[model samples]
Target: MPGTERSLTMRFLAEPKDVNFGGKVHGGAAMKWIDLAAYGCAAAWSGKYCITAYVGGMRFVQPVLVGNMVEVEAKVIYTGRTSMHLGIEVRAGDPTSSEKHLTTHCVAIMVAVDDKGKPVPVPEWVPVTENDIFMRDSAIRLMRMREKITEEMSAHLS
Candidate 1:
């Protein structure tokens, strides 16, 4: 069902299988969760199948333990004709405690697609509160950076 909601979270308990030889949850595994959460948020808001067009600024602030409780949050901060800009954060804590620490952050650009896998329009999103406003502005900045990089790459190719 389509929703006017702006954010979504997916939670899980990190397992040993998610760990790397260094004894921390693997970065790739965490990124997979981030993509899933972003997809859920985009699909819910657009009411259509969504595809990841770009992922930007992925950074890890801390490591997650194997037994920690993990939460991947995706927020819709901006929307274009067919693209949704999402901010994603990952947090983790001991499974038995409430204390959480930020582990990762990233921005994802997703495009709503139709049956033929072509881009389709996405619902508009407006930031109402101060925090939402900040997030929206950040998303815009990220979008501009992406555009600039693309332009620079094209010029190099030419």
Candidate 2:
């Protein structure tokens, strides 16, 4: 099943407070924005409250400077039972030039939960466009990667 595209964008004014001593935005701050964006996408797709079950493949492609406006976008790529896969991208925009550059990409898996905090099934999703196919495939790949990572982690723990 395919899910819809739910996106959110925000212009981040990198104030001095958001910068490190080196004048670059902190990775933690960027991750916080990523989470927020992904959560919004997942909740919108689920049409209910959802909790993050996993996060995957977060890579920083570029550094956001102190004055760059960071935009985070998240979309639903796949859904299964109670889980929804969200693809999130963070971009840095130069307000002076009106140029945007991709800075980070991440995948988040969220599970819809009931009032008792137990997992609940999500409604059927339909993807009727090429973009939807791309998202669905990306989600499948991310889910496979997550399974492999979990297995490796469990092996180490054991």
- Per-residue lDDT over 1-158 for candidate 2, one digit per residue giving the tens place of the 0 to 100 score: 22443655666676777777777888888888888887777777777778988877899999998888778888777788898887888898787877789999888888888889999888656566999988898788767777888888997783
Runs with alpha carbons beyond 4 Å of true place in candidate 2:
1-5
lDDT of 2 at 12: 67
Clashes of 2: 0
Pairs in steric clash, model 2: none
lDDT of each: 0.92, 0.79
lDDT of candidate model 2 versus the reference: 0.79
Which candidate number has the best lDDT?
1
lDDT measured at residue 138 in model 1 versus the true structure, 0 to 100? 86
Off by over 4 Å in 1: 1-3, 154-158
Residues forming the 10-long window of minimal summed lDDT in candidate 2: 1-10
